[model samples]
Target: MKLRFWGVRGSFAMCGREVLRYGGNTTSIELVAASGTRLLIDLGTGATELAKLLMQGEFGRGQGELPILLSHTHLDHIQGLPFFTPFFVKGNRIRIVGADPPGLSLQATLQNQLAPHYSPLNGLENLAAGVSIDTIVPGSTFTLGEFEVETALVPHGNMWTTAFRVTADGKVVTFLSDVEYPEPEAPLPEALHLARHADLLIHDAMHSDDDYQLRRGWGHSPARAAISVAEKAAVRRLALFHHSPDATDAMIDETVWRARAETKIELFAAAEGSYLEV
Candidate 1:
């Protein structure tokens, strides 16, 4: 399996020379299985660039089929869907999969984003692609193409974010973005289960210890929290992801440096446009 980070920043997009190395776009990831099955995680601002690249391939010919797995409908996570290029192409099949938010269906949540007052496209119906939305139950296990996926609900403030564990070609990768560990010293049971013994753990590391104290109730984890989870889960490697919008590249480097001192596991910050083969 192969994984790529298209965007790493969280909360919102940021840009400037200070953020050039780590990147400035919000979260979006691309994962491809050995059998050539491709999956997209989130549709953040990075998707705008990913869209441009897709438009040069089968998606450009309107003969592409892609499955998008969403952790939640937070603005930063779904904001780039309207700009996803393939949505303007007929015959491109797009399946959006996610757990619905409180009192809302997955489809309804997305349609709300494309509502007349908010989007120029007016509504999801106005998109030219053949789009379908699937709402999955939290803690469900399912198969998509060549991948076996397991999901668990992790706390993200009052809302719950879906943490995904995907296994393909005998390798495992767990995505635990936007999750906040209630107990700073230990990993949540659900989050630990999803990340247990995975080849790679891509986790939310959106704050530093000092920053986290000021935003305790915010739906994000500090690098130490992520390191604690990685240690408890015994994952092979941990990729600190979902960087804070206000964190400059230098800040993130410092965060990684501090994190390395806390854990013996292979660790690195997720950088936009970087890929890993597992």
Candidate 2:
């Protein structure tokens, strides 16, 4: 499988010369299987740039079909939905998959995001594309083309966020964003399961140790916490992801540098537009 990071920032989007290197778009990623099946994880602001690129292919002609796996409905994660160009193309098909929140179904939650008060698009019905929403149950496994996907629910402050493990062509990639590790030195069983011996693990590194002290219940993990998970899971490679919005490029560089010192696993910060084959 081929993986690309379109956005990696956390909480909100940020821009300026200070953020150019690591990028400022919030949590969107694209994964493509060997059979050319495309899967998108999250619809953060970075999706708009991805939309521009997809417009050059089948999506531009409204003949594309793909599944978007959302971690949750947080604004930074879904803010790019309305601006995603394929949604305005009549023949395109989009299946949005995510865990159902407390009271709202997955579909209703998304519809609420696009409601008149929040968006000019009014609702999902206003989109030209044939959009379908699937509410995935935690701990269930599903297949999307050649990719076998496994979902697990992990604690995220006051809510539960879905973590995905996707396997294809004998390779595994695990994505665990927006999760807060209760114990910095101990890995959650669900998170360990999703990342165990995986080829690549993209885990949240949204805060520094000091930042985490003040934002303990904000549904984000510090860089050291992510490293601890990677070590416990024994993942082949670790990509520090979901960067804090307040983090400058230099700060992220320091985070990566510090994380590298504690683990023998290959590590790097996930940067926008960076691609990896697993």
Candidate 3:
């Protein structure tokens, strides 16, 4: 499998000199399973870029379908849905899975982003006929093309976000987003179930130790917390993601470096456009 990061920032998007190298778009990841299946892990601002890239490929003429497995409906995570170009064209299917918390359905919550007051377009109803939304059974296993996916709800504030463990072509990749790690204790069973022995672990590293203390219930994890979980899961590589909107390239680099020194597990801050093969 291969992975590409479109956005790694958390909370909100930002711009300016300090974050140029690391990027400012929110969380979204593109995955190419070893079997050649294309999958997307979030629809944050970065999804716009991935959309453009896809436009230059098979989806350019709008002839295929795509699956977007959401973590949650947080604005920073799903903000790009309205801007994704494929939805505007016919014959291009977009299957959105996973329902957010409270009570709204997955399709309904996403339509809210495109409500008349928010945009001129009339929400999901305005999209081409190919777009569809499906809700999944929490903590259940499913399949997409040749990829086997295991999903479970995670602790992410009022909204229920999902963690994914995907295995394809002999490689295991786990995605952990908008989630918090329990201090002084192992990660929850669901997380452990997904992450154990993963070839690559993409985890939220939106805080530092101090930041975590200040924002304990914000549904984010610090470098230490994320690394500790990675260590416990025995994942081979940890790509710290969902960077704090205020974090600069230097700060992320230093944090990743420090964590790398403390453990044998390979660690690095995820940068937009960077990719790795598994």
| lDDT of each candidate versus the true structure | 0.91, 0.91, 0.84
Question: Which pairs clash in model 3?
Answer: none
Once superposed on the true structure, which residue ranges of model 1 sit more than 4 Å away at CA?
none
lDDT of 2 by residue, 1-278 (tens): 89999999998899999999989998899998888889999999999989998989999999999899999988999999999999999999999989998777888888999999999999999999958998899899999778889999998989989999999888999999999978877878989999999999999998889888999988889888888888889999999999988999999999999989888989999999766787
Residue-level lDDT of model 3, residues 205-250, one tens digit each, is 8987777888988788888767877898999999889999888898
True-structure lDDT of candidate 2: 0.91
TM-scores for all predictions: 0.98, 0.98, 0.96
Pick by lDDT: 1 or 3, better one: 1
Error of 3 at 20 (Å): 1.7
Q: Arrange candidates by lDDT, highest first: which order?
A: 2, 1, 3
lDDT of 3: 0.84
TM-score winner between candidates 1 and 3 = 1
